[model samples]
Target: MRFIYRLVFALSLTLGVSAQSFAQGLIRDAEAEIMMERYADPLIQAAGLNPDSVDLYLIGDMEFNAFVTGGQNIFMHTGAIVIADQPIEIKGVLAHEIGHIDGAHLARFGDASRGALATMAMTVGLGLAAALAGEGGAGAAIMASGSQFATLDMLRYTRAQEAAADQAAANYLEATGQSGRGLVATFERFRYQEVMSRQRQMEYFRSHPLSADRIGALRRSVDNSPYVDVTDTPEEVDELRRVQAKIIGFMVPPAQTFNRYPESDTSVPARYARSVAYFKRGDLDHARAELQTLMDEEPENPFFRELEGQMLYESGFIAESIAPYERAVELMPDSPLLRIGLATSLIAAGSTEQLESAKAHLRFALTEEPENSLGWYQLSIAHQALGEQALAELATAERAFSVGNNVEAYQFATRAHESLESGTPAWVRAAELKAVAQPSPDEIREWNRNQRQRQPLAPSRGLR
Candidate 1:
């Protein structure tokens, strides 16, 4: 679990969450990503999209919004996650966004201005602070003026397009044996948004432009569906609650988290939120206590281990943090972020044995997440500490390339190539980075068009 950011911090909630205080912006978590994959991949596949090709981004903003600007990308706000009462509700939203992707709404709606919202693509563990800090960050900005183009809700749709999406969402739900009741319920809850003043309206309704006819058509299809009685599974419900708790614990203020899940609420989700809230409040003792209680109840859960590891790592207990991070990787080996966290802790320790192990872990992690800027950053650090200057320089170039720093990437790649053994893998990669470092203006324009988005990829999950 991690957020895309400086590896010094940015561990994810219950998944090596960085201790960065919750703020409005963008983030990534493995747990959240897998959860989304489970929810979205099925719908995306049903919509004829390649599941692996599609991307899901978790927005840290509080606004209840989800959209597919174009292609296989879906942006979901944390507010939508917290606002949802169950997993199916969020799935409904995912299905709707998939509808947009299938319909190629961006192409039809003139997505020429779409490249304005730059993002941290090709990463799993991320919190692009430079991109998500509203109008100021380097991310998601209009290149000409760095305007908050998408932040202020720029992706409006025609009423007909929205209605088509509604019907298409219903079709996918029916095909997947999932109910649209949650979607209907979600929309109905905000049915009044249309009548509210634009200032008072939710971002979703404003962008979607809902009407009674649209709702009525969707309700009719849902009411007539055979799967209308279907609901979220127990596992889905549990995970959704945990995701909500963790997001609230991280994204919401500690005061608001305490208010929402107060002391009297001893439920796991409440405890989870409070644990994060306590952590955010600098009450490590209380935070550990709450987390320990959770660990005792579910000893097999890796998230507890990841959270503890993150806390210890950030607290400067570099040696102590290794055990839990190692255990987390052991439990969920497929999670690149957990491996990155373990590698990070090991790199910080700087032992010969630890650095070697960190190198191995990073090789595996970087393979799975080649675009993780922080992973490359950590790899660079590990290589430097291990006295592998050429490899370190190559890793630095990779990191620079991952973050779109073409000039720096080119310079470092050239330096690495000069020292690396010819015909080696490192040399080949350095050559590749240097090759694309100085793209033509048209190529740069095209690359940026395909890359701009709201956020990054998957990482460790289950904040509860």
Candidate 2:
């Protein structure tokens, strides 16, 4: 797991932070992503939505949250992943969110998730609980005072809407041969929140409006389900535990991780957590030892190899990290994360041949994940090292755009567009980025259709 925590969780009570800050708080892990997909694909298909069409993100927020926003996108907080005790619990949460997506519930939140402004969807969800989420004092609210209460008012769902989503979630679980018991159990856990003040309850409860009647409706569905007794397979359980262990290892303090997964607990998940804890504390020797044992036990697991590479590269053993990174990419060639890791290691090697190889790997990885700002930044490094100034400028522009820094992106893109031969593909790309960073007054775009007033149309996007 590449652990990253930025200003994503409840972002502070202050206002005026740029949309770019929202772009910076996404995390990527091959194992965690695949685990999410394995659970989501079936439920999405069951809900009559194309699994491929839906986008899932892992946000670096510590507060437990999972929400559906613009374009069938699901943003899940790492806190939510750690909070789920059972595999089915998270799936149930996703099923419920998908139900909201299926019903287009966000339409009521107002037509707010338009281009470059898609980051605002996150703000929309967070703003609903600003009054309570801030926890006290300056934590009182996250958005500006002017629009905060209006957002809260608009986001409050009707009881009927909540019930309909619950019904739909139940039906989808049944369709996918999943038990509704998990869904019912999840609701039951949150039922106590209904009686609490909104300021004292979870952000989810405030927005979803849970009630005893809602729990009863789901319980009834579960009681009547033919698959009520179905439980997660052993593989599913192991995967979930490992993923939970990874997030905990990254987010929790070393002492807390050690206490949670004591040394006597010799399970893979326990070792994984301990290794991450050690890594966090800069205990490279112990981290490597724990990981070596894991690699020996499961030589074919790509994530272990990726982590090994991460440990070595991040700790400045760039040369030694290359083999493991290459092996990880070999094990999971389709994973853009692994590929980017390999590219980073290759770039750090600093040899002419290694630099060329790094460029190739980055080209392929960026094709797979163009929104990865780090990859674009590295690509710029590789290009500059190779004396490809125009390409480096283009890569710089791309990196800037990926992070929602239009001013910098426009500056670099203009330079690239002027330097490159006009009408060439690279020049055209530079032109495109330039246009996005600062579209002229004459540009025609429906993306501008929903703006409160005239402003630059940021690309309607988010990175994960």
Candidate 3:
């Protein structure tokens, strides 16, 4: 249970189950995903892709990059989102990534990767062996040739993909009644990077390979489009500011955030950033004060109340945190994230009635977000506290399975089967998990690939 408690805390702070859970460098926050979907769904719809089939993930790294892997899954870096000044800018990036998906670029990349690796291995291997055998000049020449071949192949393919994506992104913008100006501006910002050596350029530039000609092509597209001069709605602009503030507050040092978002700026985004900065720095009094001011300004804002709850709950105010967490959930009943926060607070309170309430919240949250490992973990604790031993084991098994810990999942599922009656839903579910206790890597990959195809895109909590 103590480990469960820590897992919940880590989930809150890092938007991940554990450090190891993010081996793919993903940050699975409900808010971030929602923001991305809001920007992407329109492009996807315009591109005639099924929204349900396209899964979006936010990369944890600060580098500016976006790419689509095998399926319709799009990965965008948090740093890119944070750096963009408007939702439209991110929308542009999303549009380009979707272009790659629509064009089957990932499959092409896979094919190219196979051949490139083989070529590199043969030439580089020989080159290294030659050098190691005292043929330094011959080795250098051989290695250079191999490296050049691989690099040129990659650069050519990526450059072509980038050009195609740029054109496709512009078309999506035109079709969706959105401006390509954001896309043009975003790329223009990176135009200077073209002068740098490819190795010295940012990952985004390296992967997307930009050039003056590419910029000119994009500019021409933007200039010809009817929506070129259009700007983001007031609501969209406000959301972008708040999202950026939140990212900066959480990602940067507290002192730096406070300095950037000084008290003189009483705007919602400024206050939000300062509140999170205060919380992160253990300045509980300041954090609570800022959150209270925010709540006073917008009593119905679920995110404001959610932050208040997070600050209280994370600062060890378990009993007091419940009220705000509960309020946030009430305001946004459909938000699984808020529900999980409330459930964890209730569980931490450790009272019989609180445990019951916690279970209700956790069950509701899990119903909407079954893959949420933290939700499953907390639900298990709640079930155990309520003496639902069978259900508790099942929940623990689910949490383990969600986090890729098959051994723990298997053990817990087996124990769950012993307590539940035969043929019951809980018993049957446990049996299913028990059967796939040690899923092969390929099986996991296939299941993940299929799950994206099956699930509907969850609506992001609207910008407030």
lDDT per residue as tens, model 2, 1-464: 11221112222100111122322244566788888888889899998898867888676556677776556777777788888878888888888889889998877565542332354544543442332223322222443233422243335567888888888888888898988787777777767888999778676776789888889887887778888888999999999999888877777778999999999999999999999889878898998999889999999999898888877877889999999989998988987777878888888888889989999888897787676666787889898898889999999898767655566677789999999998899999999998889843332232244232334456533211
Candidate 2 wrong stretches, greater than 4 Å: 1-24, 110-154, 404-407, 421-424, 432-464
Q: Write the per-residue lDDT of candidate 3 for residues 264-334, one digit (tens) a residue.
A: 99999899888888877779898889888888988998878777777777778899989998888889898
* lDDT of prediction 1: 0.75
By TM-score, highest first, what's the ranking?
1, 2, 3
- List the candidate 3 regions with Cα displacement exceeding 4 Å: 1-10, 13-25, 110-157, 436-464
- Residues 349-395 of candidate 1 have per-residue lDDT tens digits of 99989999998998898788777777888888899998999999999
Lowest summed lDDT over 10 consecutive residues: which window, candidate 2?
11-20
Count clashes in each candidate, considering only residues at least 3 apart in sequence or on different chains. Answer: 19, 4, 0
Q: What TM-score does candidate 1 reach? A: 0.86
lDDT of 2: 0.73
Instruction: Candidate 2: give the clashing pairs.
Output: 115-460, 116-459, 116-460, 134-139
- TM-score, per-candidate, Cα-based: 0.86, 0.81, 0.80
- Kindly report which residue stretches of model 1 are placed more than 4 angstroms away from their true locations once superposed: 1-21, 111-146, 149-154, 441-464
